[model samples]
Structure formats: structure tokens, C-alpha cells
Target: MATKRNVSSTKEEGPVIDEAIERNWEIPDFTIKEIRDAIPAHCFRRDTFRSFTYVFHDVAIILALGYAATYIDHLPSAPLRLALWSFYWIAQGVVGTGVWVIGHECGHQAFSPSKAINNGVGMVLHSLLLVPYHSWRFSHSRHHKATGHMTKDQVFVPHTRKALGLPAREVDPEGDGPHSALEESPIAMLYNMVMMFVFGWPLYLFTNVTGQDYPGWASHFNPYCDIFDSNQVSEVYQSVAGLLATIGLLTYCGQVFGSLAMIKFYVIPYLFVNFWLVLITYLQHTDPTLPHYRENVWNFQRGAALTIDRSYGFILDYFHHHISDTHVAHHFFSTMPHYHAEEATVHIKKALGKHYKFDPTPIPQALIKSWKTCRFVEDEGDVVFFKN
Candidate 1:
């Protein structure tokens, strides 16, 4: 593993940079075992029954919501009916996201002790959400293994300055640097956010958008895509089949019960589910204060600590299974159940000290700030910070 060097003077190879930037960006010296040792042993245990209970709970709420939504057509006023249907979409979407979270837990093998149970449940839930389960699961494991690696990290890899056509760092000052006005404009920011939250998930699935660049065509649905190994092709094909089955089911429902009804109940809510999925993940990894490391400075422990945990409030946190607030713990120990993550996180914070990152900024504000400022990273640093 490489260690941080204290450079006080400007070197011929690079520009003069701030000492504080280098100081703050030093690679952590603590080992992963030290952090794991801080958490109680029981926190690592997965309860099969407890995990199934959450699955049932989410499913029950989804069915009840679907049943309750049946009455919207009976409302006397069109405006009233539309309002109620809108509410159902947002409410069901939130609950549906909870289901997605559970599926995600299954992908991480944190839902149950048995791999059979975890994969079986995960396939069903993820297929319902139109996700390729095994494909995402395999790639997500890679993400956990290399969370902040500039090239190896699976998702939300920052654009390097060279990629964005920005000038060399030596040409610009350390603190005051050139920023693209149009890219940072309010209108541009809003447009980018809308595109990201609305279509980001689908784009990522189909085209590997916002993911590490791979040779040739890359897609979650493509078994032969560079994202998966030859040995994993069978599982990727299984995920594709599951998605096809779900699509066929949805199509049958559309034929049986008018396309408009299907749109109102399923399609809209599904989009919102995608929105929440993208929002949660984007905010977790992308932040101004967070550092992305070149291969030399990157290691599993440092890469894992690159993530930030943010509070989405009690309601969102609960329904979302605390994926946002307890993310640091999740990265450190991917197999730890979500039920015990909050407890694990408390001990992790103590163990990590200043290396632990938790951003308490309200979700909306944090979303905007990250979008505006975290446009790209310098192409030439061992440890790089995002720059506008």
C-alpha cells in the first residue's frame, strides 16, 4: 500500500497546491480489521426470520396501497380523483423503494444467512422493479470493493479534468480555478438533476451511463457486456430472463386492464422508484468534500471511507431501510444487516474518527450543492477533490 507524502514546496512536475488539501487528503492508516473490531459481534449476525418479516411488511403495504387505489376512479370529482391518484403514486413509490432496498440487501447477502434464500428473494423483488438482479449484484459487489477508485469503481466515477477538456492544474491557481459558467448555471443544474433523477437508472442499465468506461458496448442486460466475467454469464442471463418475465406480466396487465390504468398505478410509481434510487446513490458518493483517489493512493479501506452518510429524516430513512445514513458502515462491512447498521455506524464513527464522513445537510440542499460543485476532478493528483 502507498503512503501519503508531505510536499511543502512546488515540484517541477506539478503545480503549487494547498498544503491543507494534501493534509486533508492523506490516506488513512487504520486497518479494516480495527474498524470491524469496534462493532459488537452480534451486529454482524443475519436473522432469516427478521429479514423475511421486512419483505412481507413491504409487500403487504404495496398490496394494501394497490387495493386502496382502486377507489380513486369512484370519486365524483375528476380533480379529486387525480389528486388522490397522484398521492398514491408518490406514497407507493416510497414504499416500493423500500422493497428495492430489501432486494439490495439481498444482493449484499445481508438479508439472510443462506445464499439460496437471499438470491431467490432478491430475484423476485428486483425483477418486479425491472432491474437485472444478478447483473446488479455482481457489479455492486465490485463497487463495494473499490468505492472511491477513479478507474475501478463501478458507478458514479467522476469525470477527470482531461475528460472534460479543462486546462491543466498548473495553469490555474490552487483555490481559485476556472469554472464553466454554463455548466454551473441554475438552469443547467436543474436540467441535469431532472435528467439524472428521472432517467439515470434506466440509462445506467441499458448503457452503463455514469459508470466506469468499458470497452465496446456495456449494459446490465447484456450477459456478454464487459461488466461481467464469462463465468457469470449464466447468472446475467437469468437476470435478463427475470426482467423479460416481469415485462411480459406488465404487458398482460396493460392488455387486461387498460393501458391508462396501468400507467397510473404502475408506470408512474415505478419512475418515482427510479428517482429515489438514483437520488440516494448519487448523494451517497458524490460530494464536494469527498475525495476520489488515483490507483496509487487507492486501497479498499480508503476507498470505502470515501462515502458520506446523510440523514434523509426518520420517515425516509425508515422506509428506505437506512441505506443513506448507515452507508459508511455498509461499505465497511457489506454483509452486515441493515437492522444492525445504525449500531455498527456508531462504533465505526469512533474508530474512523475524522476519516468518517457524515453530511447532515438536508437532502434537497445537498443534492443541489453536489450537482453544482462536483462537476469534475483534476486529472493529475494522487488524491483529487471535485472541482466545479
Candidate 2:
């Protein structure tokens, strides 16, 4: 409801680097030299394609899982069928995380050496899940650039008391306040769901509702928008084509397996796939402790700089790198592939120290902790960056 503008000046903010560790934060000339040394030494550089081996393997695994699901009736007992169904849903969610990563790579222009390839790959993967690739890529890149900044940061930034105004009711940022209003009201929930990704992608394509208010070519699914600043309509076409192809496949699967069987094997897994997507993305940005900037205090750097790195530990290491686990590093150096993120976090932590925060306890504890202590509005005056 507040129509404030961003008025914070970079001059008032002082230097970009913290003075105490500014000298130490340097890539250490030796390390920079060492990092540069490997550029040409390795057969693949950042832009170079790494054989597409993972893509093939991932696709093959998905296919194999699909096949297994299709034949779940072949299982000898009820328990086996139940086990297979459980495996299918969880595996789909996990694999779907990879799929989102590939789309994210498209956002970074890292999925393949060519923009053409990245767009093609990104659109297909994202579209199959009903996301609009260009819409997300545009805002997402801005999110990376402005991770922890108080005001301009995208996704979920914690709101300060001044931002909320003294008269406003204090409520949970993730649930009662923003969420309840968004969910319980059709219009509000429509906006929330759209902004939050349930229906955000397509609406971005068709409406350009929640993202940065780029006036000109922003809403259309066309290539004119700045987000499409990376790829072309060919990528959009691929997404459409993927839908068509999937429709054909679904039709065939249904005909051969019958609607109920297909529902058990395919539709259920497909629906469940995005549930984790919603949950992962929701928890990543929406902690009550996280800050969202009011327009005046919101600066690009401050908003973007605010994020918490979550520890999903071994599961994230073995699989979901693109999820919330390595999120802090991802926010800082987004162009780096998820594959390189875990390694980079070590260097980053040594440099960032307290600036880097990790919720080491199981997410369940974090969730409950967040619900209780994180309630209500934090004063911008008192909000502490992990460094303090």
C-alpha cells in the first residue's frame, strides 16, 4: 500500500566492502592467479559444454523411473506397489530439482555454450513444469544481483518496522500476513500465487504482474523483454513444443495404461513434483527472519545481499545443489554452476565468516524456530547483518 520510492544513495552507504575484512576478502592475488591458471588448463571453461553427460544421465534416469512406474502393477504385492509409488513421487521431485537447475542455467546462460542451446534447454525443462522461462530468468537474474540489499531485493526480503509503518499489524511474513491474505482472497491469492510461482510464470508471460515493472515488452512472451535479453523466440517455441510432445506422450500413456493407472503412475507424480518445488522455493526466501526492504531504504546491493544459506547436507550434496542448500553462494556468484558451488562455499565462508549464515539444524527445527522467534516486524535500525 505504501508507494515509496528508492532514495538511498550509494554515497551514504559508504564503501562496498567491509573495511575490517576488505583486504582479506580479496581473492588473494595468489588464489586469483591460481584460479586464472586453470582457465585454459582444463579442457572445459565456464562457457564450454561438459559433454552433456549429466543431462543424458538425468534424462535416462527419469525415463527409467517412468518405465518402472508404468509397470508398478507388475509388483508382486501391495507393499511393493506402495513402495514403488513412494519412490516415484520422491524421485520425480528430486529429478525435477535438476530440471529446474538446468532452467536456472538457462537464466545464467550456462546450460550450454550457445544462447540458442540454453534457451532451448531451459524453456523445455521449465515449461514441462508449466513455468515461463523468460519471465523467471529476467527477475531471477536481478534477484542474484541484488540478493541481500534491504529494499530492491527480489523474492523474499524481510520487512522492517519503518517499512511496515507503526500502525500496521505485526504478522508472519511467510504465512499469516502475506500468505493468508494472498491465499484466502481470490484476487490476492491470485497475485500471491502468481508472484510465488504457482501461476507466476504464465502470468508473467501473459500479464507481467508481479515482477519488476518493465513497461514495454515485459508482459508478452516475446523476445523483446530484457530477460529475453539472453535468448530468442526459438526457446519459447521449444517450451510450447515440449507441451505438445508431452501431451502426445500423456495421451499414449493413458490409452495404453488406462486413466486410473496413468493417474497413479504419471499425474500423481507430476503433481507431487511441483509440491516440492513450491516448498523448496517457499522456504528458501520466506523465513520470517529474512528482511524485505521498504522502497526508501531499499537499494540494489543491500536487498540482494540479504539471504540465508540452508544446509540440507548430504542430500543436497548428492543431489539438489540447485535447491536451497548452497543458496548463499548461488546468490553471490550466480553464474557459477551448481556443480562448482559447494567448492566455492568453502572459500567464501573463510572470507565472509559471520557474513555467511548457515542453518545447520534439520529444517524442521529451523521452520519451527522461524515461526516463533521470527514473528512480527524487525526495525531496520536493529536488523543485523550476520557480520555483527
Candidate 3:
């Protein structure tokens, strides 16, 4: 069992830690049943028609955008054409991510009560987005089951102090050990952010970057990868088949439409979809105020509470289906559909009280802040917060 240190004694004995970092990081006393009870029963009901409506709504916008792009080249002014194409990329990327979110809902069986319907829709949508649907769905289930568990959570698992080569607590009790010069440099940070937004998703899918370490190969594409069970190998292969089919389709489209047209119509906006996916997930789980627990201190209720809710403003929130704003509720009740998440969130806040974390910082500022501050956690604590 992991042991907890007295917070007051630690402050007095070592160098002063930031007061803001000194939060109530103890394990929550509440039960998961209590949280479930807090939410209204109706919020748990799934509406298949309403779910399909959103899927249709997003697909219609994407089709309209594609149709609008056909006229961009005919515009008399080059500058106007360029500006509109850029607008189309950004707009389509945003809506594309909303489609991705719906697929995610389907993976969680929140889109409908019928598992087959959910999987069928989720498989097609995610496969179109180049995601291996069943592979990600299975691994993502593990992520939720063990969110904020230091050794167990699947993605965005923070590096430990020792893993990063930071000095031991006894050697640098103040935790003032300097980070590598390159890591602290602003230019390096910018470069890293660009690389992350552009390539992070592919790297994660191919190499399991930012995910838990496993023996031998660990990839979303590998049916035998450690992230899945023996029984799930067939499903993993199905995901792979779906991904291959999508790739074949895209290859055909690129040849038929010409590569530049394909790039303009698909690739650039697809990159933006990757950008939004990384940004939203990174900010949701990575914050200095959030705590990750060692096995002895970890529980589903506590892990779920560690998630942070942030507003991406009204417009983005609507398009993205409130994924950013109501994440805490989603973590607690993964089966709850997005349309009803906001209603459930109100009750979740009351149930969790001080334990529920919400950050109101504008997303751009919050992204920078988390990237700079949430580097790694201490090696020894039962409950540890990220340290710069």
C-alpha cells in the first residue's frame, strides 16, 4: 500500500511548495452509487432517433462545405479563394471533430441502447476518420475503467520523476531540480506543440505514444497488441480491415480528384481534426490542479473526479457537442449521451462538491499553461500532482 505524507509537515520540512498546489489531494470518501443517484434517471435514457439526427446534421454540413469548395477555384481573385479555402478547412475540421465525437459516443454505447447499432455506426464513422474503431473502443474502455490510475490508465499517462531523470526527493526535496534546458526553452515548446498537434494521433495509434508501457509491441493496429485481450483479437482484426478499406477509398479518391484537390478537400481539414482531438483531450486530463493516484489510493470515483471541465465558448461547444464543457459528467457516466450531459453535470457538481474540478481559463491560455506546467509527477506519493 502507498503511504500518504502529512501536507503541513512536508511544507515545513522542505522548501515551500506553491500554496495553489497544496490542495486536498486525499481519496474521496463517496461511493460510485451516490454519484449515480445524484443524476436524474431520465438522463440515462438513450434516444436512437435523436442520436441519428446529430449524425445527419454534421454530415450535411460537411457535404455542403465540400460542395462550396468546388466554386472557390472559379473566383476571380486568388486572395479571396485562398481565404475561403482556409475558412472551409477550419470549419470542416470543427464539424468533422463533432462527427468523431459522435463515433466516440457510439463506442461507449451512449448513442443507442442497442449494442449492435452502436457498433455498426461507430465502426463506419471512425473507420472513415481512419481510426481502428474496435481497437480504440476496447482500449478506451480500459482508459475509463482506470482513468487517473498511475500504472493503469491507457493515454496521457504522466511520466514519473525518475522516468524523466529528475533528482530523487531526498536529493532535491525542494523539487527545484532544473529541467533540461531544451525542455524549458520557448522555441522548443513551440516546436513540440506543432509536432504534437500534427503527428501525435498517428504516433499514438502506431506506437502507443503517451499511453501505458507494455511488453513488446503495443499498437492500436496490432490484433495481438498488449492493449487487447485474446478474445478481442478478432475485433481488432475487424478494426484493421475497416481502416484498410477507408485507406483504399481515400487512395482512390486522391487519384480520381487529383492529389491537390484531395489535399484541399480532405487532408488539411483532417489534420485540423487531429489538432482538435489532441487539444481537447490533453487539456481535459492535464492540469497542475489534477491529481493522479497510485493503486492504493485510486478508485473509479476518485479517478473520474480528477477530470477537468473547460468551456470552449458557446459556438465551439455547440459544434463539438459539449464534450469539453461536461467531461466530468462523461467520465462518471460514460454511457450517458452528450445531449443530456449538461443536465447531468449540474447534479454531478453538487455530488462532488470541492472534488469536482472546473477550469474557466480560455482554451488557448489553458493549453499553454498546462503544456508548460504539467510535465511529470513525483515518484513517491500515493496521490501526486504534476510538477513543472
Candidate 4:
């Protein structure tokens, strides 16, 4: 045997080059081909059968949970029954939201290779959830295409105080003494969170609450809305029809089960679904590390790289199909099936090295931190990062 050497004397070098390169926001020398080469060829292939298996699996659990809630509602013990029912709603809501993620995959053409199958399933699932599928699909596509573009991004376009006709001094308050008017008071924060979780998604869809500001009133469901062009009118109308059908279905359910029963079973869980949707998207895009770029500095690769990967715990990861964790890869290859996204993400992390942003912070803490820190950007630069 050879004598043992003191290898500990020679230390590993830090990733200094990678760290410096990550901060270089101009453009990257590394091409997309390098990333593609890192991933296995099989990861690019979509298997419709396997995709449907997940859809069916999530649907079965959702139905079982719904039935369980009904049984729990009939239980005699008031406090125990209420506790069980609350747990059931939370469970069903999360599982149902996972189903919505699959529908989103369909909209991205990742559910299957067949566009017809993708559209058909997406329309059904999203419509039942009160999302106009075609309308959301088109707008979400635009978001992906222009992810980091400040002025062009369709959703969560943060504006300067001046743009909103508020004084800059109001946003950047005098000293560290008191919070700015834009800062939410503790009670107000709680109320805002409740309202956001309950009605944010529907309001955003119908009224463009946090979406891009258009010259006139803009609504996602309006076929002639500036978000869509003339060619998209038919698809928008189809989406409208689907939403109308879902409303009619809700009406029938209310009539049969009574309003309170309907609210208990369907409405509350629906709200939770919207909450998950908005929360996931919000956290994915809005982070202090990510910079929003103007047209002069924006490009597809840089825009796509702005997304962050988050950990949502293993059990929830399985339930949510790893959407939170594998979001970076999803942005890069939007048509790649969710089953393959994790593997793809591993390869991307390898390729991106220090440039890949993964935040392991617990979601609640992360959410609060982002809400406090990521208010708005300045009006003067080609690149803008969040402030206060």
C-alpha cells in the first residue's frame, strides 16, 4: 500500500469565476445548446399515457376527499366535526390545485404532444376552476415570452410611485422612524392576505387587478381586450362559453345542496386553489435577486433565468407535481412534461452553476419577506430590481 498523503493541505478553490459570471447581466457566453447537451435525451420526450395517469390519480384523490368532507359534515360532535371539515377542505384544496397545475401543463402543451388533447383537457379543468382557459393560456404565453421585461410583462407589473401619481417621498419615507403609506399595517396586512387568498385570482382575471395597464379597461374574458388580437377572438369566445358553463354548473349545485353546503364544499376550496396559483406565480417571479429589464437589455435567456426554484416540502412536492421546485426548467423548456422536469432541472442547475437561483426558505417566511421587500422599482434604468 502507498503511504497516505496530506491532501488536506491543498484546499479546494472557490467558484470565484462562476460567481463573477453570475453577476454579469449583459449576456452569457454559454449557449442554450450547452444546457440541452447536459440533459438526457429521454427528458425531452412526452408520454401522454403517463401524463394521463397523473391526471387520473389527482382526480381520484380529489373526489375521495370531497366525499370524505361530506361524511365529516354529518358527524355529531360540533368542534371535532368542524376541525375535520377544515382539514378536509385544506387537503382537497391543495390536491385540486395540483390538478390545476396539470391543466396549466396542458396550456403549455406539456401534458401531451397532441394540441387537441391539451386544449380539450385544459379548457375543461381551467373552466371548472373559473379560469378562462384560452384567455389565460394566451396571456400566460405572453408572460413567458417576456418574463423579465419591465414594461411588457403581462402580470405583476410593479410601477414606480410617480407612474401611479404618488410622491416618491411617500415610497421612500423620511427616515427609519415610521413605515411608508405603501407599507401595510399589521391588521391591514392580515386582511389583505385574506382577501388575496379569497378573491385575487378572479379579480385579476376579470379586472386585470395586478396585470399590465392598458390605455382603456382591460379584462381577460373580453375577446376584444387589447391582450388578444382579432385572430384570437374565437378562442376567447370558447373560453367565455366554458366559464359560463361552469357558472351554470355551480348554480345547479347550489340549488341542490343549498348555498351554505355549496360554499362549504366547493367555494372555499376554489378560493384555496386560486390562492395557491397566485402565490406560486408571485414567488416564482418576484424576488430581490431577480432584475426586471427594459427592451434595450432584455433577451429570452435572461428573461427566463429570472425565475427562482423553491422547495415546498417533499409531500407537498409530490402533491403539486414539483412545480415549485422545477420552475426554472419549466421556463426553459415549457413544453417538457412535468414528469421529466426534475431531471431537466438537475441538468440546468449543473449548466447554470452559480447563476441558478434556488431558495430553500420556508414558503411562509419567504412570502412575508418578499411582500415587505419587493415593492417597486426605479424609473431610470435599463435594468430595474425591486426596492423596499
The C-alpha lDDT values of all candidates are: 0.88, 0.55, 0.89, 0.81
Score residue 15 of candidate 1 by CA lDDT: 27
Indicate the residue-level lDDT of 249 in model 4: 94
Off by over 4 Å in 4: 1-29, 164-184
Model 1 regions more than 4 Å off? 1-23, 172-178
Sort every candidate by lDDT, greatest first: 3, 1, 4, 2
Worst 10 residues of 4 by lDDT: 1-10
The estimated TM-scores of all candidates read 0.93, 0.67, 0.94, 0.89
Judge candidate 2 against the unseen true structure and give its global Cα lDDT, from 0 to 1. 0.55
Give model 4's clash tally.
0
- lDDT by residue (tens digit), candidate 3, 94-159: 999999999999999999999999999999999999989999999999999999998999999999
Task: State in Å the error of residue 107, model 3.
Answer: 0.5
TM-score rank, highest first? Answer: 3, 1, 4, 2
TM-score of 4: 0.89
Query: Could you give candidate 1's per-residue lDDT for residues 311-339 as a string of tens digits?
Result: 98898899989999999999999999999
Best by lDDT: 3
lDDT of 4 by residue, 212-254 (tens): 8876768888889799889999999999999999999999999
